[model samples]
Target: MKLNKHTVATRYAKAYYNLAEEHDCIKEAFDNMMDIRQIFGENPGLGLVLSDARLTLAQKRPIVDNLIKNFPELMQNFVLMIFDYDRMGDMELIVDEFEKLYDHKNRTILAKVTTAVPLTEAQKTRLADVFVKKLDGKKVIFDEVVDPEILGGVIIEAEHQIFDGSIRLNLETLKKQIAK
Candidate 1:
């Protein structure tokens, strides 16, 4: 059977998360994963090189080792294992899944907030406070976006739900009501 990337990533992330939990180094592990994600993101070709069939493990090992030399021993071993399993191409997905697990465990929610203009620090704080109450007291982290097309008002997306209060949406709703 062929396992999809998400399934593979989830499995690896869960295993790593469990290991981190067992060793009581969840925060450190999370930080290391973030660093790895950043490295892959900044050097997009690195994953491609690591996943290339032409490059033998011996050739890849030095690269992987250099990249992770400063990381904790457990993280270094975990990354080596990923390379061993030939899943280096899916490293980003694994990191994403690990982040989701970490956030859930920490009771943190990442909310994407869109506004016609950038929010001030005070506004951000207020929005986060409101979302915390709405999201069952989970700590809210904003991924703020500004889009003038919204015309006015805010649109918040969190936990698979969208709270759209944008003027554009409101105008559309009003137009529909008038047509009705």
Candidate 2:
């Protein structure tokens, strides 16, 4: 099968992840990836500029060099390698994949919770408790989103599964039942 963006990103990220693990610099690599990801994410045009075929390596070298100046040697090499391969445009996706791999290796899972209003510390703790049980004791990181459109209750999204208990969904279901 042909390789898509996600596929290519996963492949590169896995390689980088293994390298980081071998070097015992997973944390450092993660930090470097985050910094690079943020830089590209904020200045999207820079990736395009660096990835442009019209620009010779000589033209791009200084830019890449300045970008990775503060990075560890291994990370500096990784960043430069991406530029060398004309993969700068894919940096963000690779960073995202790397983050997932890192999180999995660290036994942490990300949860997105949507509620009608902001949750209190106690509510967050309770929700975390629920997910901790469901995730087999893996540590949970919560990303909370407050949406009044949900009406009430909460929706929990983790590992591609959604547990939606919002009043809006309940109302829709009830309306369908009544119509039938």
- Candidate lDDT values, in order: 0.94, 0.90
> For residues 27-146, what per-residue lDDT tens digits would candidate 1 score against the true structure?
999999999999999998888899999989899989998998999899999999999899999999999999999998888999999999999999999989988898885799889899
Report the lDDT tens digits of candidate 2 across residue range 1-180. Answer: 868889989998999999999998889889989998888878869888989899898998999999989888998888888887788888889999999999988878798999999999999998898888888757889999999999999999988899999999999999999999
**Residue 136 accuracy (lDDT) in model 1:** 81
TM-score to native of every candidate shown: 0.94, 0.89
Task: Point out the worst 10-residue segment of candidate 2 by lDDT.
Answer: 129-138
> Candidate 1: what lDDT?
0.94
- Per-candidate RMSD, Å: 1.4, 2.0
Q: How far is candidate 2 from the true structure (C-alpha RMSD, Å)?
A: 2.0
Best by TM-score: 1
